[model samples]
Target: MREMTIGKNDAGQRLDKFLQKALPSLPPSLMHKYVRLKRIKCNGKRCQTSDRLTEGDVLSLYINDEFFQPVKEEEAFRRITPRLHILYEDDHILLCDKRPGMVVHEDDQGTLDTLINHIKAYLYEKGEWDPDKEQSFTPALCNRIDRYTGGIVMAAKTAEGLRVLNEKIRLHQVQKFYLCLVHGTPSPRQAVIQDTLLKDSKQNQVRVVKKNTPGARTASMSYKVLQSRGKLSLVECELFTGRTHQIRVQLSHRGWPLVGDTKYGTMERNRPYGMTHQALYSYKLHFSQEGDWGELSYLRGKTFQVEDVPFLPFFYNQPKN
Candidate 1:
């Protein structure tokens, strides 16, 4: 028999959901059976599987000791040396500047040194996270950037933080700004590009298309030419709708291919710069004042930005304000 007390991080989860996370060895069928048999009780009383747990609630499990034993798995983060460029951090969240070539999560390549892993390692070393103590929750990234595109990625330190930030992002309450160097200056310095995009999963690419096309979705972004040097132009873009490679595909369709973007631009255009990956960076983030942020209320109306972008120095000696 074992008793567990719900903490703030573990609250608000359904009884069945909590059981599945707290006792991975227990089969789902058996768990339901146990609940029916009064083997599981909340506050010493029988509880339903759908009952939501709250902070300070206690759960008593009258089951086999074997089910409580922890599962053995490789914790790859332990072996990785944490390397992160922190832009902002608080008790509920963290903003990390992920560099190019770093995978945000594990991919087909079986890479171990990933951005999330580094975050875990960093938090573990700081004593903010312990996998053994957490039955279900782990530090998680709220958004993801491509492996080649460097940017500021948000990490949630708590379950409530993750839920709130995800909702804000979905509602377009969180604004994201990006910087990229393109081969040619945009004719109309500033404008919004709106079009439907169809993605080819097999090819891992996207293309602009007419509306109502099969599997096509709307994509939009507003961009401005910040500076012009020779034939290249520095552009700042804000995403109105996030599609797969939306900025790259939309701009390239309008004859303004991003520098070093071999997938969307001609080899001759990228060869002059001797570049491989696209010169794009998610440099700034702003949180809207409208909405209930829960524990993350402090982040409302706040803005965080990355000062140094890897490709920015090469284009201009002085930094852009």
Candidate 2:
């Protein structure tokens, strides 16, 4: 059983329609049957097919046990050609430029290589990784870049380093910057986007909500247009509140989808460039840890810039076809 509160976007919408959006994996037939059997309730009252939803309505749903399963995170990292850029590294942390077409971790068996695997291999080769002894140290990435998107990726060598970095990220103390190429230039050149996002598991899509939306989480980001090239524009993005697909969804919502982002932007818009995957790079990161910027051993007072990709090295490796 699960409970959700309706918001402004869901008001006046049919109960069935609202349910479909809230629970993407549940079948319409199953929902209908549950509603017919009075297993589903709105505001503690049985809802019918014609029941219209309203803001602040409380919904309760009964789902089967199949939906609940224990998740096992993969730990094995495969060895791939080290095609990454080593921007900075120390005893406690690693700052590397992740390349495109490399996954951070593997999901299935006998599959493609991942960044974690390669990193593990590198550490082992350097006598940095040893599991047999208690003193053996392994590297763990605190943040990730999309498999198709390349940029600065962070990793921690010690457990304390991981804990500190993860905490700093959670507290928004770590500043992350990204360079991206978009289809069109935003009018304001600089602005902030605040919205709600709901992921459709079945379609593997995210629905951006301009107003209040049920089951949606608030996400926000700040962006500035830095340069323009023909129909494309270079933009720098700073994440205010990190949410899944926040940058992609917000840019797409503003009608300036990232270049080469086939899922969000128009294919015709990318035809001239013959590109795939948005040209985005996590170029810089700055933060003060333990309230002492100078005392921090790892990447303090440091910046990473990839000099290869022209304006943005992570994306658009070669000009359009």
Candidate 3:
């Protein structure tokens, strides 16, 4: 038998729904059976799964220990020394500042110490995650920035937070903005760049291709000049459609490749700062959705911006305000 108390954040939800979150590994049929068999109780009394829980409610589950076992074949990554620069955090979500050179997720590099691994270790140390107790739930990053682009990345602490964050991203409710330093001056000061981009998987690079070209996808972004000094110009770009390397390829095709982006940009301007990665940063994220966003409704109409850009001063005579 295990006793659990309902906290204020989880008080208003129904019993079954709360159980689904609390015991993620337990099957729904088994949960319903526990309620039907009176093995689950609230406030020292038998409670139905439909019962609405209030704050200070005491819940007891009289069950076997098999439910607490770790998931088979779902191995948890071992804890590492966490190195995260957290910008904001709440009960359900966390906003972290990712620096350059950190991989967002596991890929061809086999379990290289990544931001996700750091987040898991941090959460585990803080008691926000339980590998032995949780069946399938793992705290994960909701949004991914490229390995070398430093900026804000969203993370979810709970299952509901993760679900809602993904939903908002899918619907394009979460608006993103990036800042980059280009080598040459772009005409008209402000305009939208539209082009079709093709990705070369073998080379890990993207290029602008003709409209009728095979495997080409439409990519577009709007940019406004933030500041210009000498041969460099700082521009702010907002993506109309999210594509892999969309901003880099489209902007580079217009003859203003980002500084230190040797993949597309010329390496002539890559000096002075000895920069290894691009000077592009995902700087702002605005949450302006129309409808309800479930657990993240409080984020609507809000904008989060990060200002810890490492290469801003090197490109411009005066830093961008």
Per-prediction TM-score to the true structure, in the order listed: 0.92, 0.68, 0.76
Order the candidates by TM-score, highest first — what do you get?
A: 1, 3, 2
Q: The CA-based lDDT of model 2 is what?
A: 0.72
Task: Give the Å shift of residue 197 in candidate 3.
Answer: 1.2
Q: Give candidate 2's TM-score.
A: 0.68
lDDT of each: 0.91, 0.72, 0.82
Off by over 4 Å in 3: 1-77, 318-321
Model 1 lDDT tens row, 194-293 = 9999999889899999889998999989999999887789999999887888889999999999899988999998897887899999999999999798
Q: List candidate 2 segments past 4 Å from native.
A: 1-83, 108-112, 134-138, 210-212, 289-298, 310-321
Backbone-clash count (model 1): 0
C-alpha-based local distance difference test score of model 1: 0.91
Candidate 3, residue 36: the lDDT equals 91
Q: Which whole-number lDDT from 0 to 100 does residue 24 have in model 2? A: 51
* Per-residue lDDT of candidate 2, residues 229-293 (tens digit): 66778889998776766688789888989888888888888777767677777777777444543
Model 2 steric clash pairs: 77-117, 78-117, 273-320
Who wins the TM-score comparison? 1
